[model samples]
Target: MRFTFMCKKDMVPIAGPHGRGKIAIVGAGPAGLAASGYLVCQGYEVDVYDKLPLPGGLMSFAIPSFRISINSIIEGVEDLRDNFSVKFILNTKVFKRDTVRRDEGDEFTKNTVDLRELLNNYDAILIATGTWKSRKMNIPGEDSKGVYTALEYLFLLKSYELGYLNHEPPKANKVIVVGGGLSAIDAAEVMIHRGADEVYLVYRRTINEAPAGSFEINRLRRLGVKWMELAAPKRIIADATGNVKEVELIKMKLGEPDESGRPRPIPIEGSEFTIEADMVIEAVGEIATSPFPDQEYLGIKQDRRGRIIVNDELRTGNEKVFAAGDVVSGPSKVGRAIFLGLNAARNIHLYLTTKRISKGGT
Candidate 1:
């Protein structure tokens, strides 16, 4: 979607300086970049900060290279950098709310920066940090050495694929992937491509509940990745080396539909079984838990899921702050985040330039 910051002819030049207001955007992913693009177009100086050495967040690490070419992402970022007055602060994390707050003291705190200081320095701030926390199964032996979250495994694989790692690939032969979502399929496919001798996708429900699109599921089957449906992993069995050796599973049957409108899987009595594998990967989902506390602080509010709450204009309760992407909407597709980023950027530009909020706060 196209996003522009041009004002109506009658409402031009009423807010502040033209293209002179400073804006800080957290996270260098699609949302952050998109916001930067629109803000820059409207004459705002934009600086993007990220914890990673590179931009693109999950798009750069979690997604397989085959699905999204690295060159394309680089080109997009480069375009924004060249055309817009955009600065990137990589390898720097905004760990605490104070990091973005205005400083009351001259000295810096450990792993914390003053948010108030940032507010005084910049005209506005945009929070676009995407969800990086992985959800755990809470099952036994989950802490086993060979167990990995989907993002962790994918990040390592993509890093290796991008020449960030020179060592031999991790040993993952006879691997079992838990979950039926797109991430689960991607992890399974990558494991096989990376030389896993056997790959099995274990799902707690039927294929209908799998997160993989039909076309992708068909492709996986064609590629020979085995699917164990109606199976729930109960525990990870490890050997003396603390490496996963087998997984205990319980057979499940479909019951009443759950909140997602999908039939819930009910564990069957005395229907336990075991599958031997060298490694296990969990691809359930991700959560957005800000390093900052959820209570009222700096005029920001968090929803029940711990995502920052924002209005339609992407503004938080605080007038000077805005938010977008996964940090506000929870884990979602990259394209959706980009769309919201653009919208948020435009709204921010409008507010900064006209001093009047538009229909959409963002």
Candidate 2:
């Protein structure tokens, strides 16, 4: 049957006569989506599983629409569905290998699949599950009311704003946002747009060292967002009602460079102060949550940061398995993840075709 698609024609020719190969991909973020497109062009059947109700992962759900175009993601997803024939098992999580408890996220997952089952059934498997576990500040009262990880806060707000969620987000007169990443900027802007009387962004390092870069900070400044540099949240103080009443901050001085090549922040003794705050958003970052539970038991290795160990080809210790995007490379921009996904897809194709050719005498 003839087909119509918005994307360009077939990709560069690959070896061997095209044969139908079925593959399973976990997570429908930029990585998974890009992988599916490339694989489909290679004439492979692809099934993508995700916990969220639809595709587009963080780009579609977590990030503020003002910072990205949701419609563009929607269009790209539709093109994949209509033209590439990528099957998305939405609202389903490819559950971890050996875990009693399920991983929870902002979205409600309605179905679950065993990771081991997928490993056994598919011709090849690709894990593109980006870091879903938000990092926290090991400070007192961090668990108090009105405290939110940037991921959860952004997901909740974006979902509500998009009408997928019915409930309104938390109302705050004074919002305090921690960190200096894209997530931090997104949270601060959303708060101001939602009528917060004031929004303050606290960063331990100078603007040049910020993950979001100085441009984003300057943009926020133009919007009346206050930038409080060289300070870190020490503690969150709550009122009788259990809501956030204020935040304790410690002054920081730049020290020697850390692993990220940025100057380390050292707290100055006795240089602490308190500020009135009703909401706090921590955007420190997120860690990768491997879909394969007890990965060590299976002989797979992960770094201290919880990133999967992969070779240049993005293949794990298990030949049948491969990983791509942020899960393997650590947190990065969407464009980079998509490129890595496409590259991983090529490697998977090579592995599959090479095996088939050897078995059939080429």
Candidate 3:
């Protein structure tokens, strides 16, 4: 679907807030944007920071533009800028807690403020940093030139489609995608669309155990994307030039159900084979990056999975701090992240303006 682009001046902004209480939101993705939206409604000053030049986080680069229009993302940001007095700081990395703290206090006390400063300066702080660290295959020759994480490949494809990058898509006529999740399907489909002669999806389980939704699976079938079910990649074979040429896979069978009530794959003997492919894309998953390391020192709390622990009200253990989106819920759908962000904004407003917790004891 083609998206119509509107000039910056043409977009409408929310008129409720003119920037009152200071709010620092890390990560300018859907979650951060949503939270900023709600916070502005409550008359809070919001500043959105991101490491990337453009916002939208994973939604802007990790997914295809055909699936989620870049114009729509830009429009969302533009709308926020028009209505709310939210300022965007791009290409800024909040690497240390000190940088956040310093920025919050003096706004210019140091070159970069630390996290402690952020906790102290703003009336409230929200961490919405999305997971960007990709899981490695840990297989031999995975460092080969033609091996790429799903995010890298998708980002390149999106950049090329957006005319930001110059290069032919990797010349892999035959491609094998590792993993059975939604990312696997996305990579496989994109490869086929980009003229890969053949695309194979290698998963370590049957379709039932695959993490992809049924509709996505059906779409793959419709696109003639081949599936090598019950197969796990053991290693990547590389040529002398350090470019991947083939993938070694192990066939497996379902074992007894594990704690998650899902059967695990058990490797089968004498079922090893090699699939020739010019490139391999690993779509395993992503790990979250901890924005607040001294949580205990700062009296902040997080869940076992490293997600910021929040009550029903979306406030973190630190009364002055709030978190939402993937940072608080781990990896999840954009819709859910936005929902949580909006809720957090509302709660923040209640606390700042009304001096009352917005129910559920946030």
Candidate 4:
């Protein structure tokens, strides 16, 4: 649980005026931070930009601090800053045009820097901007006042906990979390922590197929959380004031495997149920958010799912641009993001040293 960046004690620092070409990292999350560590050790002038005021990304803002030590993340970041001379541009969003979608960490963004600006200035640009947009259920009354995405709810609470917000997030007595992912588990735990009397976790699939796995679900069950599998929320029932009062759910049965190779949950007709809920937290999933909109900006192509297209070297269509982490691989665990980041950094180092763009970068 002791999370810290790799030490660069023996490695010579190559920063300052005579260092290698500057590298601009678009995110300060695990991937971006990992790449910054490697690039800095290699003597590249590294600058990281993020929308959040802090430098730890989801580790510092969205994910629970207990799960990831905030002090450890901050310490590693401070080491990069003080020893490696890595520059962090906080509270700034790097995007192209006004088409960038508003995500969880945008609250503290006081300034915006064009993506083209970085492309023009830095020798290489690494886009590690992790997924920030939460996927919606698109059900009726989802826009209700008491309904919130897991990312938004967690971010709001974390901002308050970190003193970025003066007030606390609204509390609920009975909360219902939808989905079977880690986000959903975290949301259910947060509700318990927030003193919710009743916490229900309803998922379309069983715990065996949950993204968070069965152990976590069972652990939450031991903590008094009611786990209801084979159920999907049909809609959020709102009161006259537009506040969430209940959730209508439909029973489901697993059928043939879907595109994800997971058994698709087939809704059973006429098998509906309702759960009283003062608040609803949707943790279905998250969408990868690129700095640019849904277009091939600067020759950087994104899939229909909004994930950036990269070659074997993590190089995008633009020779000078590379991508890694959730932005390129979709939503993933911190370890996976870190691995991709280090890989991208190594490839970038090779490209910079050889002065030859890798073949098939597009």
For each candidate in the order shown, give its overall lDDT on alpha carbons: 0.76, 0.82, 0.74, 0.88
Q: Write the per-residue lDDT of candidate 3 for residues 170-236, one digit (tens) a residue.
A: 7579999998777788899888888898899888878887778667777887888887788999889
Worst 10 residues of 2 by lDDT: 1-10
TM-score of every candidate: 0.87, 0.91, 0.86, 0.96
Q: Give the Å shift of residue 171 in candidate 1.
A: 2.9
Candidate 3 Cα errors over 4 Å, as ranges: 1-19, 97-113, 160-169, 292-297, 302-305, 354-362
Q: Order the numbered candidates by lDDT, best leading.
A: 4, 2, 1, 3
Which sections of candidate 2 miss by over 4 Å? Answer: 1-19, 97-107, 297-299, 356-362
lDDT of 1: 0.76
The predicted structure with the larger lDDT, 1 or 2, is: 2
lDDT of 4 by residue, 1-362 (tens): 22224545576544454378899999999999999988877778889999989998888888997688888888889878876788999999998866657887887899999889998899999999999999999999899988989999999998899999999889999999998998899889999988999999999989889999989999999999999999999989999999998999999999999999999999999999999998999998999989988668888889888899999999999998999999999888899999999999988888899977765334
lDDT-better candidate, 1 vs 4: 4
lDDT of 1 by residue, 1-362 (tens): 12223323343322333457889888777788778767766667788877666677778767888788888877767655654436777766665653342211111123344456667788888888777777789999999988998877887776666666565347677999998888898999888787888899888988877767667777887888888899989999999999898999999999999998999999999999999998999988877644355454578778766688888788887788888998888878788998889888877877887888533231
Q: Find the candidate with the highest lDDT and give its number.
A: 4
Worst 10 residues of 3 by lDDT: 101-110
- Determine which window of 10 residues in candidate 4 has minimal summed lDDT: 1-10
- Model 3: residue 154 alpha-carbon error in angstroms: 1.4
